[model samples]
Target: MALTGAGMSTASGIPDYRGPTGSQRKGSPMRYEEFLHDPEGRRRYWARSYVGWWQIATARPNAAHAAVADLQRSGAVGAVVTQNVDGLHQAAGSGRVLELHGTLARVVCLDCGAVVPRVQMDRRLRSANPGFAEAAESVADELRVNPDGDVDLPEDLVASFVVVPCPVCEVGTLKPDVVYFGEPVPKDRVERAYDLLELAPALLVLGSSLTVMSGYRFVRAAVRRGQPVAVVTDGATRADGDPVLKVAAPVQELLPQLVSDLASQPDDDSAEPAEALAASR
Candidate 1:
């Protein structure tokens, strides 16, 4: 069973992109082409994204991630397919993770497709936006508000922030490895996730609303093939009614208990541990 999106990472203090109280009041990030064509839009995105990148990088894996890893280790989960670019799942020790979105831990040049570690971009942002750096530190307290992951800040602060261009090619466009709003999921990555789905009869949706078609497509694929689906997240989902089980709760609290209960179950070679875990949760 694969877990996807922000809900799974909420425990790590990362904000959900969209939900009842998301920053944009809608789910999902900006589109790739928009960033390319709109210079100021790019500036605004990079501003929030640059400071937000620190939180993304420094975030530790929470219980949900650890529990997922434990389930994988115990042979309860065959594989994990994630829509998140955050590397928390891998950091938590889950193997065979199919990253549906490219990782935020890396950068890719759109023109050449050459990838560089995310640290390079971080360094560049720091150098280019020293004023933003000072303002970011001053607003650190304001940034951490909305304990439930909803953050509100001044628009001017966001607008004044600068976005640095690619270091390799001054004219070359750079983007995070993550899939954007309108971009299609890479064909090979989708195929690989489908291959993993074959090993298990259930798809476990975690911490995501599944609003984006790139992710909803996988859930749709699983349902079409008669695989039972179970979801755990904080609010409404694209698959809300269809899943065999739906738990609208914070994943951090639920996942640990689910992992423990599933791990304690009797070893039955013929039994479906994924189903058992899903039912238990």
Candidate 2:
């Protein structure tokens, strides 16, 4: 099953990327081209992402992540395709997670392509800006991981912020490996996820809008393959009318109950759980 976007981690206190209460400004986050071309933009991006890492590091998976992992453990789920960079699913004990967007907890040097643990940069950030670590930890819960490892901070407080350079290449800047808007998911990653989807009998979507083409493409692929597509989310999604089963509820609240209900069904298999739920209503 594929769980797209930040909503999967919303219950864990991380905000969504773009929703009524999303973390973006003007309904958008920083773009890749802007980060590359604008020095000030890059500075701000890195600054905020650095602070946001505190939250990312501390966030634990919520019930939804656990329930999905339970499905994986039972072999009812083959894989979890996710767009989030937070790596919470693995923390939640999920075994077969396909992180479509790269992890936020690591850094990649643009010049040499040497990967470094995010902890190294965090220590550097603390050492470079003495009291900034305290300030970052204080506001960590609200911070969102930006294009680079920088996070968003209040504008008034940004004046005290400083962007740290890559330790490997003093000249080159470091950027998080996450897939930004307009950046295509690496061809190999997409292909691997597609291959996994082929193994599952049904596609279960949770807490995603599927607003981006990267995610919507999967929903389309499932439909074309004649697989049952079920969605559990709060608001309207690209899959709204197309899904075989639509559960308009918060995933953290619905998933465990749904799993329990399915577990209690008759062993004769006279009725499908989805059909029974549909009839009960």
Candidate 3:
């Protein structure tokens, strides 16, 4: 099984939280409790997301994503579990991807539980706030967008921004379908990931720091089960000492070569994992 994180999509221009450059935005991300309890927080989230959503919605899959898909096609990788919500792995043609966090491509009504495509919500926001996008673009030249489509904007701008309710429910708050800080990953998702991990001979981690337990717990589980683990990332990770093989390199530069080397080897499985890991190094 393969596990990926925000760094997996960084090559496509989305920034990861707690990376070398740190968070791109000024304030902390919206916590689930805050988002649910505070009307002002919800308004602020939707306002920034209204403008920043375009960045995530438009991002394309990079070489790392393609390489993973190729590895899967070659039977070197069986399943993928990702902490990222960007849907880039699916865009790259990977079939059995499990999104640990929910996707940004969807929005769900807090009250009604009705789900809608993010593009449709974008249209609704645009229709409700006339000229808002144009005005925001002009002033947001210095703002940085995150993978979850959050951006830093002035308080005054956020105040001026308008938020729309769910069209179906009419009373519920609408939020991107992602697991926020202070929110729990649904039980079923966790179970499904564990099931995949059980079947995998080894765990291959790509482009993740595993700083949050949400993504890190799986690594811990794998290690406890005596599964051989390999990690490919550019910087320090929580699982640094746990992996049987740890390679510090950019995924975009490393994955294609690993895929090529694996493809060239014999169809036999015995020598493949070690040979591929050594060749990648």
Candidate 4:
């Protein structure tokens, strides 16, 4: 099984929260509480998201994503569990993928619980705030998009942006389907992840620092179960001090090599797991 994080999509132009240089550059992501009760905060979020959506929307699956899909098809990887809200895994042709957090392809009404495609909301946002995207582009050098598909902007710029109500209820605010910081992943999602983990012989962690419990808990669970854990990333991870086989490298370059090495190995069920791909790292 494979577990991926924001780092998996960073090669495709998305930013990660905590990877190489992450300690120095990572910004605080939006929290669920502020988005739920603070109208201004929510407005700011939507405004930034409206501008930053292009980065996430236009991003293509990178080499790492393609390698994972290749391995999955070759029977080297069985399942994938990712913390990314970006749908790159599915975009790369991977099957049996589970998005630990929700996806950005959808939007949900806070009051009515009505769900709609993100493109639907995008069209509405475009209609309500004409030239807003172009205005943001005009000051492109000033904007820094984050992993949550938002960027910090000048208050004056955000103040002029218009927000629309949900079409179904005509009163509820709409929010991205992604799970925000301080928000819990739905119960069933966690259960399904654990179930998949229990059945896999090993957990191959790619591009994640495992900084937060949201993704780190799976590492702990794998460790407690005596499952061998292999970590591939460009920086020190929370799992470094643990018993995991740590290999600090970029997943974009290394994952494809891993698939090639596995394909070259003799087809022996008795082959050792550690010897299967660790040499490639």
lDDT of each: 0.74, 0.73, 0.87, 0.88
lDDT of 2 at 46: 64
Task: Encode model 1's per-residue lDDT on 1-281: one tens digit a residue.
Answer: 77578788767877666764323453335677887788776676667677667767788999999988997887767788888777899999999888888788888888777788889988888887777756866876755522121234456887776666667776567788777777788899988887888777788888888887777877888888998888788778878767457778777888787876766666674446555555655
The TM-scores of all predictions, comma-separated, are 0.85, 0.86, 0.95, 0.95
Candidate with more favorable, higher TM-score: 2 or 4: 4
Task: Report the alpha-carbon TM-score of model 1 versus the true structure.
Answer: 0.85
Clashes of 4: 0
Q: What are the per-residue Cα lDDT tens digits for candidate 2 across 109-134?
A: 77778778888978887777788756
Query: Cα lDDT of model 4 overall?
Result: 0.88
Stretches of candidate 4 off by over 4 Å are 21-26, 268-273
How should the candidates be ordered by lDDT, best one leading? 4, 3, 1, 2
Clashing pairs in 1: 7-207
The candidate with the higher lDDT, 1 or 4, is 4
**Index of the highest-lDDT prediction:** 4
2 or 4, greater by lDDT: 4
In model 2, what lDDT does residue 248 have? 71
lDDT of 3 by residue, 123-154 (tens): 99889889877887788766678656978778
Residue 224 lDDT, candidate 4, scale 0-100: 100
